[model samples]
Target: MISFELLLGVAIVAGFVGAMSGMGGGIILIPALTLVGIDIKHAIAVSILSIIATSSGSASAYARDHITNLKVGMFLEMFTIIGALVGASITIASSTRPLYIAFGAVLLGSWAALLFAGHASWHASTQDGFTRWLELEGSYPDQALGETISYKARRAYYGAPAMFGAGLIAGLLGIGAGAVKVLIHDLIMGLPPKVSTTTSNLIIGVTALAGTSAYLAAGLIDPGLAAPVVLGVVLGAFLGTRLLVKLTNKAVRRFFLVVLLVLAVEMIIRGLRG
Candidate 1:
């Protein structure tokens, strides 16, 4: 059994990394908690709570910066919600070993995004019919460049299904799966990196809300476990956002890859042991 203080400390670090990378705290929280002998499902549920806290805490700043695409997020939420509900139900019914393997698989799949991170440019010159109809294009001021960066969101048809898949992963693993969400936005939909990341932070809270509800009903959420984690995440994520402006994108991406490597190994080991 892990001490409450240790759990809180772990969550704080997880939240900080999550805020920096837009991966949410769950990727770190779940593997760390599980390695410490918390039940996998319980760890996942608790991690989901932290995801909610981190996302909600960071959302205001992102929104105020006009980086989040509210219209696009709202439109995609319809698919995510449905996928979340189904995924949550599946998690509740599934066995522990399978969950472990599934978690590892998800983590492994996430590595693909990292490979493309430094090379991809998301500035789009063309908008699709869905993008035009939905008005999912927008711009934000880039303080670093001292100019406004405008971009169009194309390929909404593909992005929606990708969001549904992201939501499924979130609900099943008790994670925000924000990496996948950001990939859909930046890679598939051609949203700016800043916009995709901030929008992902905004979307994670609501997606976790859907998953948390199912966990709550399934008696998987222990309030004692969730409270410290949420508190830690909220505080850490707040501080992380404060530091974000000072860091370069390269710094964040490197940190993200290091964290992902560590957690992926942990997850795979746990799955195989089971």
Candidate 2:
């Protein structure tokens, strides 16, 4: 077994990357833990706890700064929660090999999206009736740009499925599913980068909580493993948030993509070996 201190150190770096990229620490933490001989599902369980920690730590500041769209997040929470429950149930019944393969595939998809779709501009030509009715629009200060940027959350109809998929991955893999969530919000819904990322962080916390109930019932969660993971991620997320404003968007995206590629390859190899 890996020492607690090593796990904590890994979690700290995971949380930093996660907070900066809007993907929760789990994407990094789970694979790292598994490499050290932790069971895949057990590593995932610990990852969920770290997600909660990073979310709670970074989300508060984002919300206070008015970067998170609360109404949008709440509306989408309905779809995500339902998806989380279903995904968690699947995780409990499924074998680990398939999960490893699935995770690798999903990470590959996320990497592709980051490479190709990350730069797409989102602008609604016309407000769809649903978008108008929900008032899915907002503005936030952009530190680098030195002005407030406004955006509209268009095409809620299409975004719901994406959110559901994100929740599925979150519960099944014990990730924040932030990459999928941000893709939907930023690419489909037309939210600004900061808003999309911050809103995703907030939503992930609640989504993780929903999945946690199922994990707890399935006897997958280990409090002994979770405690240090949570503590490290929480502290790391706080530091990440502090550094967010200073980092360039391009730099963050490049680093995030590298991390995803490494994890994706690792999972694929592990799955094939089994």
lDDT per residue (tens digit) for residues 63-138 in model 2: 9998999988988888887788889899889989988988889889878866775356655445689987998888
Show how many residue pairs clash in every candidate, following the order shown: 0, 0
In model 1, which range of ten residues has the least summed lDDT? 245-254
Error of 2 at 58 (Å): 1.6
Best model per TM-score = 1
Clashing pairs in 1: none
Which ranges in model 2 have alpha carbons more than 4 Å from their true place?
20-22, 122-125, 143-148, 243-259
Relative to the unseen true structure, what is the C-alpha lDDT of residue 176 in candidate 1, on a scale of 0 to 100? Answer: 88
lDDT of 1 by residue, 19-58 (tens): 6665567877788788777899999888887777778777
lDDT of 2: 0.82
The lDDT per prediction is 0.81, 0.82
